[model samples]
Target: AALRELAAKAPDAIARLKGIGLSGQMHGATLLDEAGAVLRPCLLWNDTRSHDQAARLDELPAFRALSGNIVFPGFTAPKVLWVAEHEPEIFARTAKVLLPKDYLSYWLTGRMVSDMSDSAGTAWLDVGKRAWSPELLQHSGMRDDQMPELLEGTGLVGPLRGDLAAELGLPDGVQVVAGGGDNAASACGAPAISPACRARCILSAPISCTALNG
Candidate 1:
């Protein structure tokens, strides 16, 4: 919403600029069903008002060793902290702080969930074990309660939420599978999935095979 507003407000200025590419940042909080529908403002990924918290977390060796990711201001933890510290009013009202994928899934399924791949992108997960890292969450001044339930990559996420399904004219009970990160899903398709094939690039043959089988 904010991104669209910014783009519309300065299409020529923003679109004409070259050199470095620019993409709008959206607030993670605004993605939730309750907040999104209520017109809650978002906190963009690049909004670095949480630099102090991010810097503090960077000093914790356990964070890097466990998560295998640096505490960058763009990640959710920092953005979350920024909201908590600066916008207590909004923070108090937040139901959950979700990542981009999780946010979209919420609107689709009318359920909120975090899969391993998306969770790994946040600095709060232990990628090796594919679970949330307590230390990371604690250091970020967030609680595990703030995160959605973690599910495997192949798990059945849930059926589409009623209102959303109705809006899309999808039948009730339609399955909503847990989708992977786009690259990972492409990798799992066809020749890439086989050990004998080594194309070194994403191939569509496997995707076609899966689509046909389904």
Candidate 2:
């Protein structure tokens, strides 16, 4: 509805647009079945039902070292473990896992892909390598096939679906960029370019603190 409203308000601008960039809350797990149907309600970043799982994962030094972040209950990996334990059926049927923004990107572009900053919070990425960690995925009982293809936030994610473009009254082939997580995107909006500079977003619930690196 919000997108439609925006499109309606500025048809000319929409037509003139070259590409669409997405930014959404990080860590939320959006699982999809083989047919691309949502398997369950997305477990959001603030959800803490996976505390036990997080604690267990945190005890494993490799998780913290590889992810370069604490194994928080709100992160996607713990949530996946929680789902596997509490909702095995859904876990068994899950063919793909995506962060919130990537899920939206899939809807728009028909491609299963994710970006670095968002995937970083999943506790399944090698932070330094900027890629998925096979060991971490093994620990989480997730397979590489279930993960989305990764790209940098600036990478191209092909074009929007033809039907969606027509429905929104926009030109066909509006490219979708592999955008970042909310905090990372917010950091890009400010003039925080060095390690000494920090960007904070208090407006968002569960406010984010981002460290800008040169």
Candidate 3:
């Protein structure tokens, strides 16, 4: 139904869709196994069952240095750890971890990939350097192989799957693009305005306040 709506709104939807830009809920963990099957319902960014794990990770100097951010109940790393400790069987079988938008893109394109900006919020990437933090992954009880290949927000994600295009009643090979998290995506359009003022602000997703130069 949602797919139909997506098609309905865009005339010649698939062909007209030059590229897809998604702004997913940051920190939501979507675990998939080797077969590409979802292991369980995603623990969304708002879920707080991992609060204890987040706090424990916050005190780790190594994590702080690598990620340049503190672990929070809403971040992906502790959510992964929480699953590992409590849902051991599922965690054991998990072969790929995706952010929310990446999971949607996967279902659309059958490709497992992520974007650097979105990955930054996971507490598993060096935000300053824009790459996965191996040491942090190790400490979080996650394997390096389980992560999706990261891309920049502007990177190409190739064509849309033929079947999906056809199903949506349009041309094949519509291009896709890697996208960023809510804050990062929004930041792309946020005007600097004036040095003393700000054009935009994101309440969550790092709670950052960037003071732009006029």
Candidate 4:
């Protein structure tokens, strides 16, 4: 609805657009059933209902070693685990899983692709290699088939769906670019990633901070 409203406001700009970039909250678990139906409401980045699951995953050395981050309740992996434990029927029916923005990409392009920056927060990607980790997926009771194809933020995710493009007043050839998570996208926009930078703040649904070092 918001997207439709935005597009309605600028039909000229929408028609001129060559590509659309997506950026949304990181670590959100958007589960999909075998038929591509949403299983339930997305577990957002700030949801902390998976604290116990996060703690259990955090204790596993492989998680920290491979993902290069502590397993937080706010991450997608633990949230999925929480769903598996609490909503067994939904977990059993889940055929695909995606972060919020990536899910949008799938809806737009009919392709399941995700950017490294967003995948990193899911605790399922091997941060060093910038790819999905089989071991981590196994640990989380997920499979590679359920994950989206990996892509760099700059990579193209193909053209928008023909129907959607028509509805949104966008051209048929307008491609969708794989984009980073909210905070990572913000960092890209801000000039705070320099080595000398000590700290940076982000104000959003949940305020956050980033620290840097030379």
Predicted structure 2, TM vs. truth: 0.90
How many residue pairs clash in each candidate at the backbone level?
3, 0, 0, 0
C-alpha lDDT of all candidate models, in order = 0.62, 0.89, 0.82, 0.89
Residue pairs clashing in model 3 are none
**Per-residue CA lDDT of candidate 2, range 1-214, in tens?**
7768888999888878889999999999999999999999999999999999999999999998989888999999999999999999999999999999999999999999999989998999998888899999988789999999999999999999999988877788899999999878866675344444533322333244444354
Q: Please, what are the lDDT tens digits per residue for candidate 1 over residues 116-136?
A: 665665678888878888778
Top-TM-score structure, candidate number: 2
- Winner on TM-score between 2 and 4 is 2
Model 3, stretches more than 4 Å misplaced? 9-15, 192-214
Alpha carbon lDDT of residue 76, candidate 2? 97
Q: List candidate 2 segments past 4 Å from native.
A: 194-214
Alpha carbon lDDT of residue 208, candidate 4?
Answer: 49
Candidate 4, 53: how far from true, in Å? 0.5
- List, residue by residue over 62-118, the lDDT tens digit for candidate 4: 999999999999999999999999999999999999999999999999999999999
Candidate 1 regions with alpha-carbon error over 4 angstroms: 1-39, 46-49, 182-214
